[model samples]
Target: MSGQRSDTECRGTHEWVSAAPFRSHLADLVGTTGLPWRAVALYADVPTRCVRSLLFGRRGRVVRRIPARVAERLLRVRAAQLNGLTARSGDAWAAHDLASRLAGRGQSAAEIALLARATRDEAALWLVGPPGWVSARSVLLLQAACHAAGMDWAGPADPWEPSPAEAAA
Candidate 1:
């Protein structure tokens, strides 16, 4: 994590997920939910430059700090849209998908709630439609989630240690 990097550089270098697939999936979700591009972009914490690159053809660094909760919400929304569930209301879900996913990833409910609350508050502070909305939300969610999950103070191996099978591999 120590190196000369541009402000626009992505925080993590490992490609756990591909950006193109995620962006396309998100576009479909926005279309189905009637979520304004600004709102979706805001909630996802995507940078203006990155969003422009995604929606348009501009080139930029890939910024992918999507909250586990937001990602879960997007997945649920996409699934509902595909299944024709509820006919499209953004507020039908209260963002528990992120919490659930965090728990599955070894986070606790208390931690998830704390992170969600902080993220919602931060998003509200950013006006929820500003250009930096997504980036701000992403930063807050990650920071809060990491803190709540105790990952911030854990040893490196404790957080990223390979599973037994992976070690065997």
Candidate 2:
């Protein structure tokens, strides 16, 4: 049997979007921006290796799975470029955006945890805190949930870092 399954057979199932398609789309969008891969990685705070893996995909070696968070960040980067927005400091906005999307979908922390393969406390932490130190693995899971729900991973162009005033306070 082919790897493909009928929608009727997998109606309620959630499969991660294939990295190959995402990689292709990313390449196309990024190419339009005229920004180098290193520049994009630096601006987006994504690892260069992730970009290379997505773009090149281990020609004769074992393919690496593009982390969901990286893909989501790239989506945001593309949105920023398309919208003529400037790149910001950190990725806190991304976590906030994901949390907001999840909430808008009426998904609870427990549900997010289940989707992200994390504990309830961990999911809540990612949503409630300063977006500090979430594991890449969890991001992959959350990104999958976002995709399944038809949510836009690209968020508003809010500054992720605290303002100097806010930092001083």
Candidate 3:
């Protein structure tokens, strides 16, 4: 009677990792680098609010389910190498790096954009959310993904303005 119920039995509950580590990591990434907000936004496919949460270390809601396979595919590198690819080749590498970082941390679409190397507007577009927007949950997920990926990234500028060469691309 104690071990088994007449109709159903109680299962163990599971608690996932807290959002704090993730947020902190994101904040550090943002604070230390000069990566473009738009780039990060586009890469992560998240909104500004979620990005802000990660940057500011605020707690936001998060989606329970994660599309792990899709996330992994997005993070993985496809081709072996390119002959004359520059460091800023259409921001693809940057995006891929961001994706890898986010995938590692278990971040959602919103969180991805928020912490990417793009603008808030770009992030919102990627997330398909409104402009200048984000959520606490998205931030947490992004942080998680970055942590998972072991992305020790550092940007070159503050506010992430594109170089003249990159802008031309």
Candidate 4:
């Protein structure tokens, strides 16, 4: 504990807070990282739709406030952290390449998640560009997605390194 509040420390479980600071932080992330709203939101675990609405305005309506969790997560985000999510230690480059292939073939993030039986967050995190340090399961999910989509894909050539965990990206 460096006397700095941890990012995971939540003050209030249910509370409403001003959206201005969150919106401004997100805008700064986008400007600095040059990423789409979806990717940026995924990095911070915020609802992409809400972030989009907050930034762009929904139906000519201004968003005055957002959920405390949303604001907290958004505020915790750093510009460098917006680069993308990464696995702590697993299939480093394998999933990175596989995701790129799937993306190149015009597979939407949603489609990838559906085919892999994974969550949208996983798809967004791994499928985003120039990703490194991917989950071991990411290799499986992307491979499953490719096989399901009949993409004529091939996995990394160094033989399979099976992940101990179940596959969910």
Q: What is the C-alpha local distance difference test score of each model?
A: 0.41, 0.56, 0.38, 0.59
Candidate 2's TM-score:
0.37
| Alpha-carbon shift of residue 77 in model 2 (angstroms) | 21
Per-residue accuracy of model 2 over 45-127 as CA lDDT, tens digit each: 55545565667666555344444555667767664453242222234455556765797789898888777566888778767
The TM-score that candidate 3 achieves is 0.26
Best by lDDT: 4
Tally clashing residue pairs in candidate 2. 0
After superposition on all CA atoms, what RMSD does each candidate show versus the true structure? 13.6, 16.4, 18.9, 14.2
Task: Please give the distance, in angstroms, between residue 50's alpha carbon in candidate 4 and its true position after superposition.
Answer: 1.3
| Displacement of the residue 22 alpha carbon in candidate 3, Å | 1.1
- TM-score winner between candidates 3 and 4: 4
TM-score of structure candidate 4:
0.48
Count of backbone clashes for each model? 3, 0, 33, 0
Residues 1-169 of candidate 4 have per-residue lDDT tens digits of 1222322342444477888988888888888866566556544655445677789977798888776757777788786554433333446465656676787889777776665445777667766643544554345556545544455544221101123452344
Model 3: residue 38 alpha-carbon error in angstroms: 5.6
Predictions ranked by lDDT, top down? 4, 2, 1, 3
After TM-score superposition, the amount by which residue 14's alpha carbon in candidate 2 deviates from its true location, in angstroms, is: 30
Candidate 3 per-residue lDDT over residues 84-135, each given as its tens digit: 1223233333344455455455666555665543444455453442334333
